[model samples]
Target: MTTLASVVSCLSDYDPNALPVAQAQAIMRDFVQPVSGVARVPVRSALDRVLAEDVLSSIDVPSHDNSAMDGFAFASAELASAAGEVSLRVIGTAYAGVAFDGAPTAGEAVRVMTGAVMPAGCDTVIPQEFTQGDANTVRFARDAVRAGDNRRLRGEDLARGSAALSAGRTLRPADIGLLASLGIAEVSVRRKLRVAFFSTGDELRSIGEPLDAGCVYDSNRYTLHAMLSRLGVELLDMGVVRDDPAALETAFRTAAENADAIITSGGVSVGEADFTKQMMAKLGDVTFWKIAMRPGRPMAFGRITSDGPNSQGAFLFGLPGNPVAVMVTFYHFVRGALLRMMGATDAGAPLVPAVSATPIRKRPGRTEYQRAIAALNDRGQLEVRLTGQQGSGVLRSMSEANCFVVLAHEQGHVNAGDTVQVLLFDGLV
Candidate 1:
């Protein structure tokens, strides 16, 4: 049986660039791939795209100091020594988008509406609701207003030349609103990564096709396509390729010429009919071909370099044929690599802590990633229970599970109530 130690040694000694998970991640981290340069897109179409450059404010957000309420703008000294009743002459009126023609003098005030620019020499504002008004004058009930009350200062939201959006920030709805507030009509963002995906095997068929006696409808392609769509990736569906080497090679050549990355589910294991490994050896250098985790032990990573005029290169990930294994390995490895290629500096799987609800027995060698349903207990702590079976082919078990209860490489049988690390599929998928 392949053990975790054997797997680690094989991967570490395979090549200078191929190593254990940590080492591979470190190498990927150090090799910085340039983000595809920005494209000018309408603000409406820029949602979720990473900002290619910092956005500096071209003008103050509000543009001018304005009134925050429908009130009166007046000199503070006019009401400084007033009794319970204070009166002032109405000099002018101001509304949103219309500034007062002149400044208010010592004993006068201007009727200002919300968002109206404050008149010069006006230092205070009293809400109209709190004042007694007539044709030409208004009276305050008391000295309840303070200097600079009910005013939106110029540059309060954002100042000219201030950084409004930093580089590498993924735009969201609020970011769009902020940009709209600043009158920005367009933005520069990174283009989406184009990924080519397919499934291979003679035993697989499309969902609508008549199923042969032993063949099953392919599900991994749909699942992977959905996940990649949610990540904003442009997808090239290569469809299903049969187990013949010529067909597989044609698919690989097309993907290598067109896509940034090629992902295939199935045909990377130790079986004699596993033609993916054979083709990989002939077409590119297999960086690594096995992992130390269960359900996804037969994972392959390699690069296909072009040998023709107008040549280009691409990365390939060959996943095990089992439906559950395909999902597991994609989350653990392929997703991170894709995120890096998209210029995300801190992309990786998230590990969460959960307590076991039952005992789990396993050999003390290979790491176990058991399908589990995780829920919050009465005490609001995370508790996980294993799915029905642990077979790699148990796709239903994984579909019903919300998390993976992880057992370390050296861990043996775990007792009930033992604390373990659980990776939730919610965020990752």
Candidate 2:
């Protein structure tokens, strides 16, 4: 097992205070281990699940040479010497699900539909639209097609006995379709990861509770539930834990025993009432970092263990209490970590580039994720503009934006027409 001490000792430039974003990410990558259990599930139930083994194709994709269009199939020798127009006698008709049994002579053509198996001795197909033909014969221009045109050869898409999909791949919709084409009915995939999360603070209240002078309804848990659901993880919500050491420790132990990972929002800052940091230090090997980033600077990461013989530990992440900070932290850090725990080997989210529609104020030492709207400009080029407010506590900024303009740590102020990097919230549908 990889411990926090081993990971920290390997870092030559490790600094808990003012750590860079890349450094923190490296630490996280070094500390995580993928889960090993696998379950056999139907292809439909394996959506978004990571593959446990390679899936090889049992047969060729097309299984035979097929016609790619609704046209007449004939030997290319008949049209080789024709100057203006070529004509051939129609011998038989071949539909998509049926094959032509008879081989066509040199001057004979077989009427073929799309996906029909290519008739014997036929190497080319002339689309129906390009030809003017009758029931007995078909005529087309000499240059309409070349030899071997519009013919889908066997195993063009996927060859038999080849790997159709590899292990550690997170299955998407297109992957499911590919599996169906390969006649794969069931797949061995990693089991869904279980994550236990909670909110900590005396000032936080549930939905039905009355709003006293200093208490506000908790929104972090609701957002966490939705985000975790999108990531396809089973959730164990522990509700709000008061700002007491005993209650906090109880929540931690319970979460450690039941979940593969524990997520807590609040009580990790440098405030005097924050007992979470102390309890976390006592319970396990945890590290508090002040990252060089915006909206999410303070975070705690480590693993925690419970007492007794039957105890099993869980990975821990302490997020900030602010509404937007919680989401930003989750997306940038916890999301990838959870995917790794689920045994997925997909690369991190890709960042797209677009022109900045307006100027942006930035510094050189800290990375920032500014909420922005990415849309096409008058020239049909992608451009991005910041939302109304960018305060860490304002959740509306995140809602109003479709993408986050990622300003790098070494980047300075951006001009109006400068290109900026962005991570989209929605991909192509």
Highest-lDDT candidate: 2
Clashing residue pairs in candidate 1 (N, C-alpha, C atoms within 3 angstroms): none
Q: What is candidate 1's lDDT per residue for 73-191, written digit by digit as tens?
A: 98778766677777989988999999999997767899999999999988778999999879589888666787678888889989999999887777879999999988899998887
Cα lDDT tens digits for candidate 2, 275-348? 98888998988999999999899999999999945557889999999999999999988988888899888787
Off by over 4 Å in 2: 427-429
- TM accuracy, model 1: 0.74
TM-scores for the candidates: 0.74, 0.97
Question: What is the number of backbone collisions in each predicted candidate, taken in the order shown?
Answer: 0, 0
Error of 2 at 66 (Å): 0.5
lDDT for position 398 in model 2: 89
